[model samples]
Target: MAKHHLDPQYLDPNYEPVVNRSGNTPFGDILAARMQRRTIMKGSVGAALAGLMGAGLAGCGSDDDDDRASSSGVASTELGFKAVPVSTENRVVVPEGYSAVAFLPWGTPITGAYPEYRPDGTNSGEDQEQQVGMHHDGMHFFPIDLKAGGNSSSEGLLVMNHEYINQNALHATGPSYVNGLRPADEVRKEIAAHGVSVVHIKRDSAGVWDLVHGSPFNRRITGNTEMDIRGPLRGYHKLVTKFSPDATETRGTLNNCSMGPTPWGTYLAAEENWHGYFANKGASQPREQVRHGVGSESRYDWELADSGADAYVRFDITPGSGSAADDYRNEANTYGFMVEIDPFNPQSKPQKRTALGRFGHEGVIFAPVREGEPVVCYSGDDSRFEYIYKFVSSQPYYAATAGGYLLDEGTLYVARFNDDGSGDWLSLDLEDPDFAAKVQAAMGTTVGDIVFEGFENQADVLLNTRLAADIAGATPMDRPEWGAIDPNTGEVYFTLTNNSQRTEDQVNAANPVANNQTGHIIRWQEAGNDHAATGFQWDIFVFAGTQGTETVVDGEAVVTLDDDNIFNSPDGLWFDYNGRLWIQTDGSDDAPYQNNMMLAANPETREIKRFFVGPTGCEVTGVVSTPDVRTLFVNIQHPAGNWPDASDPRPRDATVIVTRDDGGIIGA
Candidate 1:
């Protein structure tokens, strides 16, 4: 069989080809520097081990049934349930003591007369506007009574991103085209399924989880919803589209992947892979568009709608006989941002926090907030050889008055991992004297292939974020995906999903394997445990591969998975309040693990075990648990065969609610 390394999250096989030619030190060298061969375990991590393992292999614990202990003499992670075996069956599987039930499948109504879902995909565009969307990704559960100072687990608002759509499963007979033009209504339905959904859900007295129909807080933020633009690039010239001449607004958020919940209780929907939705058929595209891969063809072909309406025409970014404000040439620029939504307020408009910078944002993870310190958050661009970033708010966070505006003013920084297990966060703001000095000093020098011509302004730096990172000498990673912060350790963990295109010479410590078919997780500790810290120590966490398989470079020691804990493409990541790191995968089923799955890891002992396995042809992504940790919610996207309902031919993406049969704390 051929090696499958490209992430399954890519919409097209050719999408996001290796764009980073920066020749930065690969992560493999970094790991090799920190590694010291000790004992040659047959098929386990011999030398290259978890960062927490240290030089003596202290914290690396065994998850075996009879050996639930580590060399450090500390107890293994308090995972209460037995690890379930991997499965290719078309069904959701949980531990023997847990129950997995499907809830709120796509098209279940919650607003505007509660339009019922039609399995045959006959729902009209208007009907879809009031219904749930397709391909659920990142999600969060906000207690309904949160404002009242109560954490109500029984009732809460479940807000999640509808990443993208499956055209075959959406339309009755699939999409139709005549003379290369699509029906306007079909295009409208597709648009309606691309943003975020806020639904009110409740666990009744009978312990059944269901959606609350007609709840005031239940509403859909679709592709046509009018949103406010906020932060540094708010009225920038590049955002001046025909729909928003003042550049203070934009319609819709697309390709929203994983999300981030702010310390102030607002939900942040990260826009990822949004570049594929727009087609720039112009002679020459700007650096911003070219750097992010906005080419001549769109993924859905929505721009070729026969009706030629303003909304439909905007998808085609080809220059017209007019300026940026007169034509739709700048439409794509309005996307690729972090959109903040207040789930508590149904009337509040979602705001695009442009100060966070623009790129393929896989997700955002905020650090533990302090009463009078700047709010800091981290995000990663999910493309081959892209960079990871963090934003620090200029204003100190005050719980009493804090809200989404805290994200309006911030300094964005890109990371640079060094071979010595040390890394630095480079400031992307040109206004910073230090950053300005570096840009001025390197003006004539060529770093990556592009000349260091210093940015026009702070707004220009953000508009061309990827290009700015390239010029700033940030370390290009192997497809940085979902991120999670250890609630107990203050360490940040990011999934460096597979990058098959990485050549032998590109192998480095953070990403040690060339032709990286199965990816690994890399983590770092901020200086003084401060999220805003500029320097830090780093290490490789775990390398994803088959049991006993040696994923090595020149015989350098990398981790090997055992039977109980093996996975690929570690994508979605979350740390429950108790510090149990939930790791989800989004890779081809053929890679050792026959199906996409979720695993629970004890960051302390470095012990991991599979927790849940999704159906065939599906990616197990988003994850969140109720306050008491009794109920866990995991999303299964793009499942194949009959799922949730064996009799139903049309499989729908849905959230799986896992609860203990005895109603104990989940994952213990």
Candidate 2:
């Protein structure tokens, strides 16, 4: 596939996204460097033998069961559950031994006095605030007991993201764009609907999870919520706006997709595909803004709201009147960073941690942390051709003193993978003259040249993270989505969710496919098995494909799907406490695969089994399990498949709680 311009048809498009338009000069440099190293290593038989036995070996039908042991020395066992059958039916289908229950559907009351959800879709903005939000995505279950070990099985605060609004199902008559403008109320409702929600939940005597109505912990952080701008870009000029004249504050977190739970007991809600919400009809957009796909037209036409309030006006990023402080031109920069929310403290203000370079952050997962050691977190830029990034805290992490403050100071680095299973993490710090020189050379221009534009400092380097990565010679990936680190090993895995734009010539040893309809999972072990290591050994763990169209690597099939387990577009990913890797998909509900589904994989044995299938038109995402491993929670998004109830006038996005019929461990 070829690179294309950002299409304004959908709010996110990242799920079915664009390719990086940046020239391939940097990638060529990486190839040249790798070829030079390959020539030297080709004659070393010992080196070749080591490479073959390295941690980077792809687990394609290999019996590496001994490598699946946890750090505590216990080996993982097989996934004993039967595979769930594939179907085009409009209901959730789980393995025969498992049971699925519809829980926390959109518009369900969580707090205050919201009227019951009307099938005709008459719920008001006020009602939605009190009720559950739409499009539930990445989430985590934070147990009430802080000291509880395992998966926090019994009760906890369920923090989740309401990604975007489905207009057709959100209103009685859908959104109305009359006379080139949207109704102010309709826009307000949409804004209120797109953010994060926190609901208190617990299991009862029957082992069914239920929402705790009117619980003090229940709250919603909508598009209008006040947020503090923390870290390097807090007082930077690029973040100045009428919302916060000093540039230390902004409003709300839009397009929240996946999330990460910090060891310090807070939640990191990622802002993905937020560029589509802005309408920057300015004469000439900034270089960074342009690189991020900010355009003249808003994706949801939210800027056309007929309201003069700053809340609605912020969506229009065009400069107006006096100076930067007098307008909301910089509002767009305030988003796209990981917003840290203290789930335990409802009164605490959410912080936008700018130290983690901004882009389309799909999600952030922390590497295993050790006391007195730097804390590391990894994230992916979901858009095609984007890069993977990691943040290393300046100070050591201590469990007792852990909090959002540690994230305030950090150095961000982008990854560049080599063909010989090795990769480098290039720091984004502009202070490093050597690093700056490499960036200049890669961009084929001097530091003060037009390529640098107005990006003069570290803040600029971070605000335009994609440009910096491109200039720094980082490797571009095919829609790198959710990432997870194996608890047993420090190995990192990223799902390169599919890129139709990747052509044959663009295919490399790592991303080895043309028109990559069924994506692949790439993993790496940090050098020395250290989370803070800047180097890593990499490999493709599994290549997702249909039953008949299997993917082969190095003369071996990485993973072969069967009739019961075929899937595509691996999106949401999570590794449970038990080390079972849960893979979720967000693909087209067509022939071979009629609906989005969730599958379980035993990484060691390279065995994947289909465990659950979502309804006809929905994407199965966000997954978590109880401490006991008996109860599992998965989110069903944009359910046009008429799941749960085919008779309902409008389909509802809800969370499905899965449990074994025998009340045993899930997927056992």
Candidate 3:
């Protein structure tokens, strides 16, 4: 609910993720300017609406009938989004009759006491690890009782990613003025709060979803939680850290963002913008940027301002007086991978599967696994013109398969777009002398200077993976973000979120556009539509734009955006069990569109419609649906942007459960 009003000078009056975080704007001037713009905007948008063709709205409910259409190989109804207004005062809104409940939220008990969250900010580091976290993102519910060995109880296992902290929103009343520092203890607690939480969920007879407190399945993996790494890169001497004596076990997972669920029912949580956590000294120098992902703009700038203490120093990633044999500059190399965690098994240590090529991993979507063929996963890097990646496990998959073990053993390949419509998956193996040379060359100075000051070991190369990608020549994309796989067709779809950083001249065959502010969603059909195929052909499925908006057109509107389903900044993506594609927007486009929203599309028809929109200034992201197609789970993240009044930041971060009031299937 707490959100900053859009500023006109720093940002265009369109739906967009770009915000002027410069904090230089005078609030008084902004209010005055906004008043003038509002009058002008209302007229322009009103006139624009008059010329546009109206798309009829379909009231929200089940999409079960869509399955029948797919079964007959017929294109079902085109999907569109209709605002589901469950609440008027900055809250989760759904269609009429459909209802929701908070599955889990910050400070909620896991195995600890069920303490009601207090606005006074009375949480502690030790308590944080066992409690729920802020900004819930990607999540999935595993019906243990449905599968052959799935849990038999009516209760289910919920695996959700806890993204970065909302320091302002946490503990109400904002910052506790302990001196000037944002209490290092608060920072420490935050680090421990961001990761994966596996909780037992149950739908009571009333159809309301609730956390099963004290359930044996409840557990939290924090930034400081112990874990191990496995793959060709495992224990390659690049992962060693002060804490990881074996170079395999890692201290924790940070900035846990979107997630992927495995064919074997395991959870895959991604680490996004992780490079910012390590404050590598001398970043102002251009040379430092080459070695690490951290540049000038990082969310975790705390490392820059904070004194090295309470483990904060470890994040400095600066050359230390202590031996590489002494400090943690080299330890950062362990993060930014698709960490696999088994929700059902409490004793299982989370595993970072290096086989999945890493970057700013948004999420990985699993294709139907075919026996004797590699199991494929789709990944996106949430960076401007970064890259979209895929990993095909060298091992074949079995039907009705789940993959914790096979995930550990596989080839992680980055994608390369060709001059033609075809593409190739580049292997990240050290076998390529060119790649090895380039990476080793870049590593020379970093090892000698900062990351591993005393001991820049091979581990530095692995953790500073974006640098490694550069050496490997991985293809950069147009702000690759979230991804989804077509269940009926097996084709993969990914969102290239808007990237203004790129110029028109830099555009090439893959990118093909300069300053592509309105992004596109791309899809590819693997050779033979086989998951293991190395060669694949791709096409721009749809250029997401409001109807009448000029966008990349692929002849057909395979994935077009329009008023019926008008949305922007395709970020969170998921295919429900029933095969309807759910698209959540981040960094929504300019004005007339008040807030970013969620949309549902029938892929066969390429028709999209707005399903729901969040309260003011919120991104509608993080979605996962139930297998029965009955319940749709979505995460409302950072509802309150940088609002000055933390106490009143109206839309608190939370996860929502959406189910049809008619008891029909979802996406129908």
Candidate 4:
């Protein structure tokens, strides 16, 4: 049997049920009703009161106009390019009059001292550290001069996440499993392949982008790099380990997937599916460990390396005699949080923001920040029956203040969706009596109950986030992936990537379809159109699939998808400077869809048009546009598609830059 599990929660029989409220009714109906209610409330309020609030709400518009303009909506500057057709060919397919150039493939040298890429996979671990990491995912670009604003689009530091590694492609003769053990060198190289990469890139006068080799800004942060632990659980007893006796630091980042860019010029790399990387064959496992899917056998089996060094033994998180300071038992608690890296300051250590709460974090997106208003961020737990989360900064945000400090003090809340088209943001704080009661009801016990060993304090609540969510009755979602916020509007959108394990009885109002293969996008407007509001109204934005396969609610199509824009498993989502939404996928390259693709959509009009389709057996993900909006970059991961060059014996993952021939803004 294959030991690799994509998400261990899928195999758990006691998975919690997701909350869905708009079953069998067109999501639009629910949205329209919410808008009407808001309008009525506004009208009923005294005119004097409305006038008093006008100044503070000048830019915050109601969803009524957006609801009206969804389908026929066009950019102030229209996207006039022809749509790209679906393809089964082993090459990237783009719209007519557009051009693409492949750059920054795996093992590309960032530092001048590293050896060039060897197709035979013979690069040493040190070589891998100095070169670009493998499996590119979400990314962001930060200009060297922060004050330049849009003019700095041509020059910036491009930072991207190296999600995971392909064992066969990383080793000369493939990974070795000799009597349940791996070679130390091979394991080291694999560790070097995970984490994030920062490269200085510049577009020349000829309209071409190239990596600036040997630039001081170019660097790679691998799984072996030192990182600091911050937030609620920083120095908790659960995090003490031999590696960090004081429990204030940890080593490296693993399974970096999606990313988030902060207003203060830093990168937030999300850790996803990291539990499988560790192994604990001890007699008994902690409740939190089992909940997060830490299994007995290692996914990579790196713990069995013959080197006997602490670096190799850390993967085995089993307890030993004496205190946690003498063993690696608590090492696993150190991962699964949003790691903040200062792209501009290479010397700055990455900090794990535990206040965000950790459990297969897909990505974190901040809502519009106003001075003196709390900074709010939204994230989704990417696993079957997982929950969506929001964090509110305890202190208000002031742009003039340092940006890195905003995340340190905050309250994390899990979402609870009711059956009546309403939802609540339940605080995860252990001090809240109501929250504790809810947890007791869900788990059938009190906090003092010894059966649930870890719920001792605030630190425990932050460490075992998933368990806390289960106790608080948060609505489970269908594998929530990346999220994006509309710049022109305050609406929040999340991709509920497909769930094939849902049975007919398991279906909910939100996820109405059973065995959902093609996923849908869900959007919500916070109460009073405020990011800090605890309540919100939501509905399905688009149901992804071929034209004839859309799911209907109340005899009306939820959202139309067609041949020119069919897609599945919406994994990555981003909003360009022009307010255009870009959707990317990671799914089967079957007929009709042909290949994973990138699409352009007008969220206002619900118009989706196919923009580009990726090569065979490759995931099309990680999209970011320059401030000028004329240049776009997308990543192709794990290319079994053999894209960019089919003739090359060894295919490598790469980033491709797209531009219009007329030098016009992309998708225009």
The lDDT of each candidate is 0.82, 0.78, 0.61, 0.76
Q: Supply the TM-score for candidate 1.
A: 0.92
Per-residue lDDT for 291-384 in model 3, tens only? 3345433344444334447356566556567655466656566777889888878989999887675567888888787667777788887765
Ranking by TM-score: 1, 2, 4, 3
State the lDDT of candidate 1 residue by residue for 282-339, as single tens digits.
8988767777778787878888899999988999999889888888898988999999
Estimate TM-scores for all models. Answer: 0.92, 0.90, 0.79, 0.88
Candidate that scores best on lDDT: 1
Stretches > 4 Å off in candidate 3: 1-89, 146-154, 171-173, 176-182, 282-292, 295-310, 398-403, 432-474, 504-515, 550-562, 641-651
Clash statistics: count for each candidate: 12, 6, 47, 4
Clash number for model 2?
Answer: 6
Candidate 2 lDDT, 358-453, residue by residue in tens:
899999999988999999999999887788999999999998878888998888999988766588898888877757786666554532123554
Q: Which stretches of candidate 1 lie over 4 Å from their true place?
A: 1-14, 33-77, 441-453, 507-513, 549-560
Residue 448 lDDT, candidate 2, scale 0-100 = 18
Top candidate by TM-score: 1
lDDT of 4 by residue, 248-350 (tens): 9999898888989987778999998788788888998886677777878776777778788788799899888789999889878998899999987778999
Q: Give the per-residue Cα lDDT of candidate 4 at 572.
A: 94
Model 4 stretches astray by more than 4 angstroms: 1-74, 147-151, 178-180, 440-450, 507-513, 551-558
